[model samples]
Target chain A: MTNAPIFERMALIGIGLIGSSLAQAARQRGLVKEIAISTRSEATLRRAEELGLGDSYSVDAAVAVEGADLVILCVPVGANEAIAKWIAPALKKGAILTDAGSTKGSVVAQVAPHVPEGVHFIPGHPIAGTEQSGPDAGFPTLFDQRWCILTPPENTDPDALEKLKAFWQGCGSDVDLMDPKHHDLVLAIVSHLPHVIAYNIVGTADDLEAVTKSEVIKYSASGFRDFTRLAASDPIMWRDVCLNNKDAILEMLARFSEDLSALQRAIRWGDGDKLFEMFTRTRSIRRSIIEAGQETDAPDFGRHSGD
Target chain B: MTNAPIFERMALIGIGLIGSSLAQAARQRGLVKEIAISTRSEATLRRAEELGLGDSYSVDAAVAVEGADLVILCVPVGANEAIAKWIAPALKKGAILTDAGSTKGSVVAQVAPHVPEGVHFIPGHPIAGTEQSGPDAGFPTLFDQRWCILTPPENTDPDALEKLKAFWQGCGSDVDLMDPKHHDLVLAIVSHLPHVIAYNIVGTADDLEAVTKSEVIKYSASGFRDFTRLAASDPIMWRDVCLNNKDAILEMLARFSEDLSALQRAIRWGDGDKLFEMFTRTRSIRRSIIEAGQETDAPDFGRHSGD
Candidate 1:
């Protein structure tokens, strides 16, 4: 671990999976001299303290960010507006205010309103997460080799942006900048849609009249288990993502439903050629993802311990 | 490895993922004294031989099954009829014939007519596979802790069924038995629909106007990558599954689409409670799958190296 801190002090609001993981990663690498952790729930704040995630813990979001040079809003997208209002008064001058929310447009819409005179408001999303949530589910290496996309507004201070990039890099992430709208669209297709689809499929399986739930669980290794992981993500977090990123997710859902309809027609008509083509083409995308090092080459999504 | 073989000789037709994995597992555990591997492709036959997956190799299914006490048809479901016809005459009179096809109902319908008298026709599906296929992809422990479901005809010889069960157990799979139709319905929800949805979503993302394909690959760790693994599964195998198990797949697909539509409506209406309820329920189902010992408890589906 480095002896010197990247920032004098850092504050993390809402110490769940992403927030707790950031704390661990930052602390492990000595990214911050002093860490302040806060959550709306006193129980979670106490739990974060018990985990030794930060040097100080508080239930007041404003109190946590009072002296911190960096403040990360780790709450759900829907809570951004309220948290922003509560903490706006306490944000130190020139502090880099950022968020680790899934949806950037909503974060911008919700929090950009109360931006203090000099604080840098940069919205970011690390392209990393486990289905699990809460502080206990987090670890230091969660962001390793993952992409962290930043959506900074125009006319923002580049120096502050560079510093934020360095901090994410220090935390084991590759940084990329994208427009907030583009970030939402890309994430909608890549993350939000996938989660919604997974939740729906599992729900469908659960509601099956002929196939029992036990059978679904027993036979899940046949592919159903993969979706269940994403479906098992934090309900409140996902609910906020759905509500806050409504338009982008709904748009992707429409495209997905459209493509599904065409595929359904192919299956209904026994168009083996079409089915084969679609199935074969999609295989290459997985290969591309592997080649790009975005995914493990280990077969079966690396779920099985065996090769 | 055990010195005593479970069977005198075993024949494997179609040396792909299932066939090759069976060869390695069976040979490693001494489940069969001699293994004969057959594929329609001479190149694959040579590759299987190169991998040392069997004691002998052949292109002719008939030649492969000759004198073997057990024969497992590992080809796609659509090819069952022709292969059964080709190998029926050469099968040993009391040989136990089975399959590892995903769809049991179609396998029984297609292969039963060609079975010679005194032969046991038990259809089975080992709910174990990786995205990668072919001779080189096989590993000895592919079936470890996985379920191998058997769907036997009402008149299937008990001794032969027991022998097959023992062989799977030797290969490290828990065995379950169900009626062939029930197996089809269960797999329709657990296997077929998941693959179809994966393929559809990848197609949807591929056809996106705003998001580039590279963006999808780069940000895949967000969630889309999970679906891609299933989408990368062997095209021929999945295509045949869709064709052979049409009705059940269609039914499941309908259910899935209906559920997805309702979820979409909830998202549009900003029904956070509805979304939260659905998401929470699905999380417990994932826990059920983990508790049932069908899935790994590692978060992020154990994709990440760190917990």
Candidate 2:
């Protein structure tokens, strides 16, 4: 745990999963002296206040950002523009402004124009979250051992970027800097496309007439249950991700579909060797992920995975 | 744990994940007295014996099944036909013969012709497995709380079917009966399609030119890690499943592709509401699975997940 505060005062624009998690993690590590949480929903604002996730809570984004040296937008990508405009007037000079959106390009474009001259704007995405959302769904350890990618504009202050890196490090994340567009592309394959595929398959299963929805749930332990976890993610967040990362997501989806067509063709043609070879090659990638410390070496992704 | 042995001598035809797990679960639960393990590969049979997975081991299927009251063909679906013909002469008259194959219709069609008049041929599939394979991957608790679907022939004797049900129950499985065709359709959606999708996406990531494989591996915790587990499953087992259950798998794949195209269109058109609706509907299915006890209520499918 950190012993010294990195930021004197921090303001969070949304009190959802990422926001609440950041609050909890930062508070536990003493990364910030004061956390001012603000959200559009009054109910959610009250809930965050009750959870004591921050030193102060308000429904006004501008009010929360006043006097804060650090302002982080933790809302869906679609909501970043409005919040940026709303808080632009109250943003403290020299405050490091950042975001935890899934798509960095869209978030940077949406929020960059409104940042004050002295405020440093850096776009970031912490590649960690569960299927659940909301204030109660967060915990202090959500960011532990996770990768946080930073996408700062070329003219941004180096000192501010380094401080933001250290702040995420204090929250237990390893930060890597990259171009916003490149981050969008890498994340399209690694996160956005995977979520789309999961949501698609779950929808397909729900529409099946030959197999009842009940049977899908009953025998879901087979494999479908794994997809359900990703499918159950917050709809608004995912919807924003899909709409914001459209081009990159579609490019990845096109490539994925082409590969899937080949796979489907091999299955249709009774090409056992092709199927066997492809399946064999994919197995090594999983081993590489496990060896890279991105995945557990636990067999079946661990015993708690419904057998 | 069961104290009484259900069968005097039980023979397993292959020593892979399913075969080894059955041996361990049966022995721990006292469901079988003398376990006889067999495989075409001398190495696997030796490994099974090295793991003390059986009372006896043989590379010859006929030799292993001799005088066994319970014979389970645990080989890949494509090998079931040949193994059935080879072991037909050695199976005991009143023995309960079954299988742990993924595709039941093909298993029945290929192996049913070789079953003798007095021998009871009740094909079954224990819907329990880990991504790992081979004799060393087996554990006694693998079958606990998992489903085991039995696809007995229409003319099967009641007493023998009941006995096989008891044997599986002793090993800690909830048994369900269904037609061979119906089982294939249910499994195509629940197990086979998910595996195919998982394999395809992992292959897509591996073939990308812009994103380095290391980048994908480093940030896999985002979403790609979940698919890797299913994609890492045994190649031969999955290949045989694809070939044997081609029609049902193709049907499910077609449905899945159609649904995915609509999702792609929604993203391309910036239809956030449509995407939101689909994501929301899929979330309820995951909740239903958890309520049905098929998934853990633990956020992110339990904390053991490598996030």
Candidate 3:
């Protein structure tokens, strides 16, 4: 663990899975000297307090940001503008304000206008999560071996950028700096499109009256179970992601639909070779993911020993 | 364990994951008096013999079924007709011949004509399997607490049906009898379609030139890795499933594409409500699956101990 503190105080404006995880990681490695948590709901704020996620908890966003050297907007992407407006006045001079939003461009656009001249605005996304949400859904090692992409504007202060990168490094993440637009595009194909497809398929299976609901549940082992986990993600969070990342999501969806149409035609024409080729090609991508160490090579259910 | 033998000699015609699992389950519980195994490939037969999955092993299907009272065809669906013809002459009088093919109606259509008179043909499918395959993948508890659906012909012998049902029960499966057409339809939606969609998405992602493939691999934790596991399934087996179960698969594919189109439009129009409702509903299906014990409630990699 790094002995040097990354920030004097860190303000987290939503103590959900990402925020609580950041808190846990920060405290475990002494990345920050103190943490303040704020959320719209008092119950969630109380829960964060119960979990010892921060030194202070409040429902008022501005109150939480006061005196904090680092402020992270950990709310859903849709709430970014409102949270930014609320905290803009209380943000400390020369403080670094970042985010853990899924959609980078929208977050940059929404929060950039509210940033005071001295504060550094770096939009970041920590590419890690579970199906579960809330303060209890966090762990100290959640960011270990994960990637955190920082989409800092070209004119951002160099010192602030370096300090923020140090914080993520202390949280056990390898940082990648990229343009916000490119980050959104990359995420659309890898994350947003997959979630939309999963949600749609689960909804389609749910609407099937001919196939008894129980039967779908009973036989989900084949392939549907994989989609179910992604589909079961927080609805509010996903909704905001789709609404915010529209252009890139649509472009990826268009390519996916085009490919799916080709597959459908092959299946209709009984093109065994085409189907076999596609299925065969996909297997190598999975092998690459396993080799990259981003995913476990374990059999189903092997990695969640404690959970 | 059931002490009464269901068949004098039970012949498993292919000693892959399903075949070897069935052999292990039967032997552990003494469901058969003797076991005979065979495969067209000499290597697979040797592997099965080394694993001691049967009392005897043969390269010729006819040789393995010579004295067998029950012959279970465990090869891929594509090989059903060929294996049925090869072993037809050697099958004992009044033998009950069944299969563990994924697509029941196609297997019935292909294999029924080759079955000789006095031999009862009862095609069945056990709704159980892992991503793994071959004799080395077999485990004694593979079938425990799983569903096994039998799609016997309407006029098939009652005694033969009962014997097959008892056999599946002894192998640790709860048996459900359904019409062959309905079984195919149900499986197309539940199993076949999901695998096809997974394979397609993984292929789509792999073909992208804009995003470096390494980026996709590194960030797979954002839901792409889940699909990779399903996409990594055996290509030949899935190809056979796609070809043998053509009509039903095509039907489900059409529905999936249509649903996906609606979802694509929702994302395009920034309809957060529609996305939220679809995402929320899908979560309930996952909850029901977990409650029904069809899947583990543990974290993604936590459920299975072996990788």
Candidate 4:
């Protein structure tokens, strides 16, 4: 049986991976009656049209958001303020305005001032993605079984909040509500820290004079390739994440560096027990993640043998 | 169309993941006429027998090595010295002795002193494994398309080294030869440092007082889950690697920490261009790895949609 549409019109401000995926998911699941897609680049908008990702496409953010009941800013967090200002006047009355950026506190700070009256301003982040980006990297099932966290302002109306949560649910995501500040802190440790570490380690490998780049690529399967996937994430998006989540990210980085120094000292002293203890404790966290259905149970992420 | 066996008798001194996989691969490819397995623990030896991983199973290391023309020490690097001392007298005069440990310098230093006259001692590392350990974690194709680096001591018998290389090739691996010291340095950056960084980041996440463990686990799919695969690797094996490859690992860790400091500075100072440049450069390495057949090209390591 088909479900009724949750919103009359859902406008995606940037037709990148997240925007394209949302359009496909909303359309395939009958979550929205019409999907209006927009991006600054004419070629990308034409490609989105060719893919039939939305009912309408435009290069102007205002034109895309006009008469839309749901407007999602899916651009990089760095581009939020400009798009928010450009589309604020065109946002329909009583529309739910949200975002799919990774950092929430910054998005609220950048977009809240420009939001029109009667528009419900909520910030969101989908805890799901692939290494690749761009519109072609999206799929209809990208949000299945993934979490979409919402950080609504304190004065948000309950009906608007409920509707947005229901809309995400219809697109096959579990919804959680969190304070924007707390969201930034938690994401710093879980998401930002990992990406920063991956990028740093890859940069270190790339600059090694003793070890050639060819050697790193040849032997990456041993361990190095695991970090490359995270390092290969969109540069603009990650740059914005690092810039916007500065305080929390810096705090997490400081802690990680401190711990790494202790580990380095342990190795210098040949303390095998300390190393083993640290390695063993982390295994349980991955186990819990797998049991919670947040990660794949397949060994090496099921890269081999497809098991 | 089948080739003749490379060695008349093959002795595997530790029946863990590497040893068990070698047993299966050698047997499946007809690389040896007879296989003998041994481990220090009686339970492990019995388990190896139950799995029929070898033609004969023994608890005594010397008994397994007697009359074997090819002896591979598959234990942790720290255990190489004692095992080498124990099995030195039993190894045949013309036998080729090797290991599958991650650290080559330490393996050479530990296993070389005990090699009897005319015994060809070659330290080898197969750059392949999963996070799982023990016999049940092994499969015949574990080394398929993987590189196996052999660090042969000076003046090693050419015929013996050729035989060892041919055996690994039969098991579906390309073999590279290098000096023991260089192998350790190369692995420190490509394999050991990545694992150490992964372990450190996971430790940092686990000890965070600001973020609950439940929250970290719940939001791990964002980016944290990628590091968990490497963090969940066999603790004992990794511990041995840290202790045995002390100098090289310390050098790589120092480089990694330095790069991380610069990255942190970029983030704190709002240097978005620097962050973007660093993130953009590492993407090409993953692409090169995929092109080299060292990594899976599927997005997210083929975890979703199985592309």
Candidate 3 global TM-score: 0.96
Q: Give all candidates' CA lDDT scores.
A: 0.91, 0.92, 0.87, 0.92
What C-alpha lDDT, on a 0 to 100 scale, does residue A84 get in candidate 3? 93
Query: How well is each residue in B192-271 modelled by candidate 3, as lDDT tens digits?
Result: 98888888888788878888798899888888888888888888889899888889888888888888888888888888
Cα lDDT of candidate 4 equals 0.92
Per-model RMSD to reference = 1.5, 1.3, 2.0, 1.1
lDDT, candidate 2, A1-307, per-residue tens: 6578999999999988899999999999999999999999999999999999998888999999999999999999999999999999999899999999999988878888888799999999999998889999889889998899999899889899989999999999999999999999999999999999999999999999889999999898889999999999999999999999899999999999999999999999999999998998998899999898777787766754445
- Score chain A of each prediction against the true chain A by TM-score and list the results: 0.98, 0.98, 0.97, 0.98
lDDT per residue as tens, model 4, A1-307: 2679989999999988899899989988999899999999999999999998999989998999999999999999999999998998888999999999999999989999999899999999998898888899988888889899999899899999999999899888999999999999999998999999899889999998888999999989899999999999999999999999999999998898899989999999998899999889989989999999988887778887552
* Residues A241-271, model 1: lDDT tens digits: 9998899999999999988999988899999
Return the lDDT, model 1, position A250: 94
B107-193, model 4: which lDDT tens digit per residue? Answer: 878888889998999889999998888988888999999999998877888888899999999999999999888899999999999
lDDT of 3 by residue, A1-307 (tens): 6568979999999989899999999999999999999999999999999888899999999999999999999999999999999899999999999999999999988999999989999999999888888899887888878899999898888999999999998888899999988888889888998898888888888888779888898877766777888888899999999999999988888888889889888878888898788878876787788787777765543422232
Candidate 4 residue pairs that clash: none
**iRMS of every model, one decimal?**
0.9, 0.8, 1.5, 0.8
Provide the TM-score of chain B versus the true chain B for each model in turn.
Answer: 0.97, 0.97, 0.96, 0.98
C-alpha-based local distance difference test score of model 2: 0.92
* lDDT for B275 (candidate 4): 98
- Determine the TM-score of chain B of model 2: 0.97
By DockQ: ranked, best first: 4, 1, 2, 3
